[model samples]
Target: MSADETPQGYSIFRDTMADMTFPEIARAAERRAVVLWGLGVIEQHGPHLPLGTDVYMPSELLRRVRRLLAERGIDSVIMPPFYWGVNQVSGAFPGTFVVRPEIVIELIVDLIKSLKKDSFARLFCISGHGDALHNRTVHAGIARGADEAAIAAYFVGAPSFFARVGIAADDPHILPTHSEVERPSRYFDVHAGKFETSSMWAAYPGLVRDELLPALRSTDFGVEDISEWRKGGDHARAKTPQGYLGDPAASDREFGETMMAQHAELVAAAIAAQVGAAR
Candidate 1:
């Protein structure tokens, strides 16, 4: 093989993972290893961001994390990303798809079980969906399904990162003066709305609908706290005609890079810890 094509880098995004023979993978297990599986919702991301915002963010971060870990001689692979998720908030917006909470959990369990069957001893789930309670419950289910086949199945994104980034503990936008916020809005939009818009713009520029940005509305009217925000239903505060909560106009690529870099670092560190513990 050519030098460039060699598995010199540890990233699964590279051809190396695809080209890896079963024997190759088994041999590599003698060192240290981990595999990352991603789950993202294909739902509304306000007026400017694409419906695939949630999916794209985790996938992109997994790619970057794979590269980062490779730099440290860590072995990692990013499996195909799951687009199914509990999308309650963006359901009011067109193109949003909601998978029932039970289905999401069951699917995750099956995914983890299969990974364990394949001898992947360490697994992590990365989600960018609306239902916090549901996602955590689902993660627990996946861990249960893994049983003794693996060590643990973890959910990477947590409230701590938002806290660390200085995002206040208020719901970004869930309730408007006229409507009751639903389950989807309460959990997902904590950092949804403009924050998600800016993030998508940073990760995948072409997915953003720039023309819609000007028309998007930025309002604090619907939000009471972070918990009351609606995840679904035809609420008055569900979305502005433009579909964003805060001002996506203020979003820049730099901020997106910063957010993504931090997430990658967290993933890499977690993988390192999990792999070490497995040994």
Candidate 2:
């Protein structure tokens, strides 16, 4: 299904916790339905894409994943999109809102506590941002939340994040790596490049500045450049002057759609496995 088309009988107001009344949410919790949360960051994705790119992508993925879950007879509820995420790498950008890692951790822990209080036993966090520190912080938050609240919670994100944070590849909470779903431009599509630009084009076309795409050039960011970019602030800006890493001009809606679909499938499968194991 296209981004513009909603599945028949699918209602956001009915599926999301934010839109439901206290009694409805209590009933969902009693049913032991998994709670889904999209973890996003308000960061710059070049001039062509909106600052909410991270939020929109994960929220869209969660929507698709929720449908897939329902098709499998698994019930789930979505929380409102959480966009106040750590943005260390893109802090130099004008629109990026960088928060302390501890703040994210505390907020997540509190969220889990509140859910646990409501009798919710499971939670799944899906993030669109790929910054190493951000992912690590989120993982830490989930870990802490599970321990403190005695709830089963998982963080789903890029497989590389596990290795970056010293988690084993086989870690149950981390989504297993799927080579089949890997992007063709994974090497260079680090930031608001062809990969993300194409994604926004497919998922939120109106938010993308299509006219600016033609003039945007691609930057061949090498390992050394990435090392500098990781420093963030001035160092990152020096490496990516225009605030993007890859070729935005090469973006294609079809590519974005395929990528999103494949990723949603992987996420749904992972969530299903985790839910079963928890049960």
Candidate 3:
């Protein structure tokens, strides 16, 4: 194998308790081992993206981030994906498995406590789906973590970074509103648009049908909060019947691969920074 393709001696699992030894685990934990958890929604992602699109995208980041951390002697692992995330808007879609918001929060809280009990140095949760309530819940759980564990917890994804790096700033469109302050006008979706389609195409070719781009591409857009979406997935279905909000035709694998690589880079850097800061 080429040097770049070599495997670093790090354990990446859906669950970490089963495969690690006590002494080995202790060595890693002492070195500030960071657990990278991939959180995603089992929801609908238009025609071109797969139903597990949210989880898969962030999992890709976790996978690559493990390799980066391994190279630096910072023990790290990617746990099995936590797919039951908050997908209130996608409830209208057939594939969506919407769970109560509290369910996700509780799951996160329990997992954090479990990891903290295990003596892990830090835990970073990366979610592909952007649910404000979900993010807030995760943050709250992190805040409640004990001082000794001092868990470094937060959410990371492409959309948040896109805005951070001036990509969103260029297009003054506020999603539901082009530009203006409005109540519950807090969310916007390019749905199966560029990011979702491209990332899926890059990671899982079997799961994506690039030929369906014509059917998936559309200019339909909408805005709604978690409460409205909780009413039912039908509302979202009515907003964008195709289950997408942006053009999938322009989603090329090359662009998708490049975007995913950059995303992985950004996420890995963030984890590294958090680990360093925690120390």
Candidate 4:
């Protein structure tokens, strides 16, 4: 990927994966390179947002991160966003496309195998879809593959790397005016709320239904599964009928820009730091 080109002008993630020669990939891996794979879901986001909110936001963020990583001289590739994920809560909702946990795990494991076989030293699963079940799958898949497949290779989550960057050390509320996130903001309203909405605005403004955002509100809420008015398990439709748990009115684009930049910088820096350490 060339820096002279804008993020919008950038080609497919598959192109990056296919760009390098086997020998070149091996040499880079021997020297400790990092490859980033974005994880997200194609699920319902309320009336105000598109189904691909998770994928769209992270695609833009990862693009910015790719540039930052390049500036730090890190040999990194941002894989295409992985949309097939376990969206248990949203499954009963009309637009949500949910996958079983084990299926997600197996796919991640296969990806790890492919990257390792091609000589990528470290694999960073940078997820935008933050479901507990999905997170567990990605973490476990990486752990299992790195342990049994490639002993010297590294596989881990982008969150842990963000922790190393320090901003996400304790769930800070990220500021919209600047990169300063308030303490414990990360812990608050993580589901399809302001963060997701404003993020949709920042990355793909045309896709967001701004006028409809005012009408979308849900007072009844429970962080735990409340079943989408369905049998056995609770879902997004139950706790958040509109499929959003945060304040859509508060999804400030200014804050979103700051948040995306902060995330990109932290992710890039963390990868560079870890690659340096591994070397």
Best by lDDT: 2
For model 1, how does the per-residue alpha-carbon lDDT over 199-258 read when each residue is reduced to its tens digit?
A: 666766666777766655446544353334453465524444445555665566667666
The lDDT of model 1 is 0.59
Please give the distance, in angstroms, between residue 118's alpha carbon in candidate 1 and its true position after superposition: 1.3
TM-score of each predicted structure versus truth: 0.74, 0.91, 0.74, 0.76
Better of 2 and 4 by TM-score: 2
Query: What lDDT does the true structure give each of the candidates?
Result: 0.59, 0.82, 0.61, 0.62
List the candidate 1 regions with Cα displacement exceeding 4 Å.
1-32, 148-151, 159-192, 221-228, 236-241
Lowest lDDT 10-mer window, candidate 4? 171-180
TM-score: which is higher, 1 or 4? 4
lDDT order, best first, reads: 2, 4, 3, 1
lDDT of 2: 0.82
Question: Which structure among the candidates has the greatest TM-score?
Answer: 2
TM-score of 3: 0.74
Minimum summed lDDT over a 10-residue window in model 2 is located at: 6-15
* Candidate 4 deviant stretches above 4 angstroms: 1-32, 151-188, 218-235
Estimate the lDDT of model 4: 0.62
Local accuracy of candidate 4 as per-residue lDDT tens digits, 33-77 = 676767788888777888877776667777787788778787666
Tell me the spans in candidate 2 whose CA falls farther than 4 Å from its real position.
1-15, 170-172, 177-180
Each prediction's RMSD over C-alphas, in Å, is 8.9, 2.8, 7.9, 6.4
Error at 96, model 3, angstroms:
0.8
